[model samples]
Target: MARILALDYGVKRTGIAVTDEMQIIASGLATVATKELLIYLEGYFKSENVELVLIGEPRQMDNTASESEVYIQEFLKKFSEKFPQMQMKRVDERFTSKMAFQSMIDSGMSKKKRKDKALVDEISATIILQSYLYK
Candidate 1:
């Protein structure tokens, strides 16, 4: 089966994750500059059979769109236009960042490594993919 891809989008950087061919496990793939996301995806798609792109959808405590939602929506529009053949979906991303941070602490990562924003983003993407899989 084709793999499922997930994204944790930010204005400057984006986190990426992918499920295995069997779609049973989700793993962190990479963290790329937002400007280069399309190029990265192009290269990835050329080698991997990806059936869907799951984007993290930010929301507030009230279940409404957060401020970052606008940026994500804009990115989604361009991504849809660029990869017209690929399917796309959104998964709620609430608390993923906090969970990622807690995960880092649980793993006993160094303070310096824990400060790595890219790592947090990557983990968040993985969490998003995992959530989708379990759902």
Candidate 2:
């Protein structure tokens, strides 16, 4: 079976996650610069069979679109244009960053390690994928 991929998009960097072939477990894959995301996805898609791409949709506490949504919207347009055959969906991403941070704390990660934004991004992506899987 083709895997399901998830992304936690940011202006500077993006986190990526993927499920197993059975689509049962979500795992953090990588953190890539925003500018390199398309290239990275292109290379990954060429090697792996990804049936769907889940992108984290940032929203404010009141459910309005977040400021970051502008960047995400732009990315989505280019993403669709670059990979028209790829299926994409958006998943609500409220509190994901906070959750990721708490997860790191609960996991006993070092303070220095916990401060790594890339690691947080990757964990956030995993959380996003897991949320989708559970849904």
Top model number, lDDT: 2
Question: Against the hidden reference, what TM-scores do the models get?
Answer: 0.98, 0.99
Clashing pairs in 1: none
Compose the digit string of candidate 2's lDDT tens values, residues 17-103. 999999999999999999999999999999999999999999998999999999999999999999999999999999999999999
Give Cα distance to truth, residue 51, candidate 2, Å: 0.2
Worst 10 residues of 2 by lDDT: 56-65
lDDT of 1 by residue, 8-122 (tens): 9999999999999999999999999999999999999999999999999999999999998888888888888989999999999999999999999999999999999999999
lDDT (0 to 1) per candidate: 0.95, 0.98
Best by TM-score: 2
Model 1: how far residue 118 lies from native, Å: 0.2
Q: How many backbone clashes does every candidate have?
A: 0, 0
